[model samples]
Target: MAAKKASGSGSKAAKTTRAIAIDAPPLDAWSDLIGHDRLIAGLSAAIQQGRLGGSLLFVGPSGVGKTSAAVLLTQTLLCERSSPEQMAPCNTCPACVQVRAGTHPDFIQVSKPDDKTLIPLELLIGPVDARLQEGFCHDVHLRPMQAKRKVAILHDADFLNEEGANCLLKTLEEPPANALIILIGSSEQRQLPTIRSRCQVLRFQAPTGEHGRQLLRKQLQWSATEDDELQVDSVSDEALDAAIELSAGDMHVAIRLVRGGGDKIREALWNQLDAPVPDPVAIARLINGHLDSISKDVPKRRAALRDVFSIAVQHYRRQLRNDAKSGEYDPATHRRLDRTLRTFREIDRSANLGTLVDCYAADLTLATTGDRGAIG
Candidate 1:
């Protein structure tokens, strides 16, 4: 197969350097993949028995191994040396190397661009003028050049809008005999019914218990050897435990807490909430300050604000549990928890960040102080 050309105007060496800089670390071997043992076992068995389906929908929380799993499956299918029954890729082979480098002739991947909220229609089908001359739908139909089959993994499947989904329906319904299509999204509920119905759904849960601890350590670069005790120097054992407890089994959340100084933010939030009379202005300022420190990008700040809300939710829940254990029902605590959850949901829909934060803080304060007037 010929080497893939880099897009845009540049010398070959410059384009190659740009591509290498942006590429994520490749999952070269199954050992490089962490967590989801049971899912891997089932998928491996299906591949070995030749029972794997043509289309698959992977639904899970963000930062889980769905994309990595897709890449691994592609390697297993397109490996030059591994037999179908073996289901193992020789990572050094040309086919495996190309796949890892994301330059494989038979492999295709697409996602919603960072600047755009939805997967554009043109990405699924060609632009109006060219029709099916380009894009994922067009490319997936081509004959495989290297491997016996072609594989296309579409990331951010949650962002596929109605028009884009419709463009993909015919392909999903009558997929090419030699092609595999995989869609990765956060949850099945986020996907449209029509799209979900046409593919095999695989639900992935966040790692928990020992699995969560191990994966957290691995991501943090804190894990030493399999037999050695977990090293703790920069991050204390208590901080690690707190991060694990608050992360809700998501590795990304855990890392953010330990590395991003999210723990400090969490503490500040708790301090504000636990005050005798919580100050809405102070609370809003605290949260906004934390958001600003984390990112200058609006979308990223919005996402981090959601995480802050999640932390508040946990705090109220913990208080409610404490009240329950003490044989005292605090209606105010219950209302605050419910309102915090509602505010959390609203973050995605609301555009005015300043207004949203101020209203949420004011509403939480009112709930705490037994005031009847709470903003929706």
Candidate 2:
């Protein structure tokens, strides 16, 4: 009877694992997309009118669902059984499944090289000696292999250098009849004017308030199902509210805050900051340790740090405002707060974070202790 019970438990475990795999969200999960209703309607109208542009640009702040929209567009274009009226792809169709699996012959995705700072010229066009039959510039002109139309998504368009942008311009100026190109970037200014001029731009904004809360709750619930540590249903409204505010409506940041040991690390960091004589090295090391524990990949680590830094800045900014209104405004304190906010721009740069954090901690200590000469 004991052996029989053991076998039954094993069978139940396998069944549960299978259920999770089957229920995993599809690539074109429309319900998963939030806070871009107007943008979705416009894109849907383009599909219904059969006026989808050859080259499209999606510009917005990070984590605002630009790429998700692009993927949904790709599905609508490639699905074997989707109609214009539905404006959504049938996720089960062979073509849709292939697109979701990222194995569709008609779809291409290009992004910045992990080892390099910018998108290389060869990656956009072809190698100089073999430009005729190589790279996205050449492949894009070819007819679709499976779907009715071909789609090419260029991610991290902000990383395009002059040569890369120039190479992409020729294709942008005169794309093939069957090709659709989508470029995703954080802002329009990041791309060359020549590249920007040739594309139809779509803007995405972050979700706010109740809409933001609903999105956060859905995401956390899904995460809890996937990861055992997350207790989405039991988490208090206050904690969820704090996460939402800290994220500033960025979906990616909110998700990371819930799953990336954010609460624990944040509390510890703040505790150290509130110390009578906070040690800069100790605080920097705390952040560095959490970052190291999260990921070995540079980009992921940088993103996690950005979220943490943003939270810290938000906390101090509130205090600054309160102090100002009470006629206790200190110039040094304001300067330090401004500098911390500015550090958000340097996450993608080559600056030394240890030194940066050391300076930030020193500034905080001076501002609170009224020792303006500490930094000097």
Q: Pick the candidate with the highest lDDT.
A: 1
* lDDT over C-alpha atoms for residue 43 of model 1: 82
Mind sharing the TM-score for model 1?
0.80
lDDT of candidate 1 over 164-281, digit per residue (tens): 9888888887789999999998889878899998988888888766666666666666323366443434666567667766665555666667766677888889999998568999
Q: Which is the leading candidate under TM-score?
A: 1
Residue pairs whose backbone atoms clash in candidate 2: none
| RMSD from true fold, candidate 1 | 6.3
- lDDT for each of the candidates? 0.73, 0.70
- Local error of candidate 2 at 31, Å? 4.9
* Candidate 2 Cα misplacement greater than 4 A, ranges: 1-32, 221-227, 264-286, 289-300, 316-338, 341-345, 350-356, 359-376
Task: Tell me the deviation in Å of residue 36 in model 2.
Answer: 1.6
lDDT of 2 by residue, 1-376 (tens): 9555444433332222112111223435565678777887887788778887899999976655677677777888888897645777888998877667666777777776557778777665555664534566766766666777888888889888787888888888888989999999888987899999999999887677666666677766655654477777676666666777777656677778866756787788777755655577787788788888888887787778888777777666776788879988756556555666656645554456666566666666665332324232
Give the lDDT of residue 301 in candidate 1.
81
TM-score for each of the candidates: 0.80, 0.75
Where in model 1 is the C-alpha error above 4 Å? 1-25, 222-238, 274-278, 319-352, 363-376
